[model samples]
Target: MRKQLINPPQIYDGSPFGMSQAVIDRASATVYISGQVDWDANRQVSCHNVAGQLKKALANLTTVLEASGSSEESLLSLRVYVRGELGEFIGDIAPILAQYLGESRPSLTGIGVSSLAYPEILVEIEATAALK
Candidate 1:
């Protein structure tokens, strides 16, 4: 399938990291969004708390989805990677997820990791969605 890369100006550019923010499969009308971290335009993790980082990451993810011609409701699955204990932050995470996803209950998975791409990053979210 032919692919199209999407890099919205609103989010941190991932090209320097050898990745695009999202890729669209023209033939299948599907979008694969790269893992979005709580990075500012300067590629710095400004949030010190998990909740704050998660909020920024989700916002970045939304920007990618929109740039890919998809919406939150079109999400097919989400893979969340957390830097620390998943249980320690579930309470802070659940509400943010609900705010972005609303009633759309797509497949979701949470994985706890020792660390993320950046030492300060607490969360990263990647998603797959059908084009709207």
Candidate 2:
């Protein structure tokens, strides 16, 4: 299990997360996935908005998981990156995570940046899954 944490009350007050103050993991098999974006088969970013990008990125993440004989339930952590509009991205992606993860909200980190490798790509997601 891997968990995310942002320490100090001053940093987490009013924050939507409940991480402790450390990130730790103990698993048998760990799968690390590269950052995923909203790229289509043609290798083109298919979305200009955070919501669309998140959907596609999640889809890609699932594909990778399936190929590894694992599922979302095996996930131990996720790192999300968004270029601008952090609030909107959170609103769009959090519900999806809630729906897919059920009661197990894996440790996660969200980073807001100014841009991505692809101009049309609004968000990127990477994951770590533990098969145990």
Candidate 3:
């Protein structure tokens, strides 16, 4: 897949916090990753709190990206849904997110919702990526 990750020189980069100004995908294959939660291989929620769930969700996202032949670099955009405010947890996710995405930090949008598909789900992540 072919793509361009653009960040204007005039604007301060937001990658360290997991964000980007724009992503251009000229690839032939585009993958729309469904929202991933903290469910383990047994199909049970693995995390009870926001911090735990955040980590689990990132791990789950990695699995999906690998299965689709698209890695974090291929990611063009991400939508994060959170059940409630996670004051300190946001701080924790930043570094982990930087590590997770490596050199690529796709555009991100964080949404706060009253509830999610599952009540136990403290966080859910959906992503879009392009690949051959």
Candidate 4:
């Protein structure tokens, strides 16, 4: 199955932020990944800062996506929850997410929350992907 991105000239580009305005997936199964934080198997938030935590969270999310027979290209959307403003890190994080997501740019929503599940956790990312 293929995921189709819909973005006409009337709308602005969203790829820089690792998102698209509209995404249509044709996979038979849909995978809902829980909010993935920087916590390891030991249930510890080893990453102390947003930059570090964001990297780990993305990696964790990627593992789940792959395990589900889905890839970043099969992703439908990502809801990002950050402890603080997401603007400052967009320049840094967007590129990394783009690299991870490759050519397929899925829809995304970013929200700034007061805190996450743990004190040391600065960001949590949840994803929805399509699987065959």
Candidate 5:
């Protein structure tokens, strides 16, 4: 699979936040990952705050990606679910995401929801990727 991250000159660059305006993927198979929360190996909520939970959730997502024979660079898109006000937490989210993904800018979406799978899970992230 081949993946291209696109940040058109006409639009604002999203690379700083680990996101692209769009993605171009040429692949024979696509991987649809389930929503990953901040669950540890013991199936316990790893964090309580939004930022902390998001960090752990991203780690879990990465594990899933690797297990699927794909890396973060192959990620096509991400749908982030937040339990509370996004504006309050975007300050914490952007930097962590950028550091985690580096130059692999994939299309990202953040949605504010009432709750998630667990009451303690402040954030959940689901991803789509091209198989390596």
Candidate 6:
């Protein structure tokens, strides 16, 4: 798995992500996942809050990763989109992420967006995972 930093130097230096000092180095065989929502396999909208949706979304991401023979530990980056304030949303999902990812949290980016794919949905997470 590749090592990704929370805040790469290039991101800070006015450069694109392709060139980043925070990226100590990188490995290959990355798996890209699209934005995951709160829907279940039955196509039912599960949770109303960010935490519940996040859990389901993470589970969805895990399914995608596993299908490609990868695990959560192989995550190189996680980009999270929230419909509101960071503190309000993250307060619910952070602990779940801590438990799911264990020690390696992976590089994270959280943004406050106007809305999500669904009106009730508050959080969506997209990931890039590298295989060892």
Candidate No. with top TM-score: 1
lDDT at residue 9 of model 4 (Cα atoms): 36
Across residues 1-132, which tens digit of lDDT does each residue of candidate 2 receive? Answer: 253222223221212333232222334456666676786645576677787888888877776666555678888888899998677567777887688677657898989989886678888887888753
- Candidate 1: tens digits of C-alpha lDDT, residues 1-132: 398999998888788889999999999999999999988788888789988988899889888888888999999999989987899889989888988888778899989899888788889999999999
Per-model CA lDDT versus the true structure: 0.89, 0.68, 0.71, 0.71, 0.75, 0.68
TM-score of 4: 0.74
Best by lDDT: 1
What are the per-residue Cα lDDT tens digits for candidate 3 across 5-80? 5443433343664744334455557766667778774448866977688788887777666656677888888888
Candidate 4: stretches off by over 4 Å: 1-28
What is candidate 5's lDDT per residue for 10-43, written digit by digit as tens?
A: 3333455476533434465666666777766455
Per-candidate TM-score against the hidden true structure = 0.95, 0.73, 0.72, 0.74, 0.77, 0.74
Candidate 4's residue-wise lDDT over 11-96, tens digit each?
Answer: 33446657543444555466766677786655577667777888888877766665566777888888888888888678767777
Q: Model 2, 1: alpha-carbon shift in Å?
A: 24
Greater TM-score among 3 and 5 belongs to 5
**Residue 54 error for model 5, in Å?**
1.0
What CA root-mean-square deviation does each model show from the true structure?
1.2, 11.9, 11.6, 11.7, 11.6, 10.2
In candidate 4, position 56 carries an lDDT of 86
Off by over 4 Å in 2: 1-28
Model 6 lDDT tens row, 1-132: 364433212112313324321222345556666676676644467778778878887877676666555678988889889888887767676788889889777999988898886688887888877764
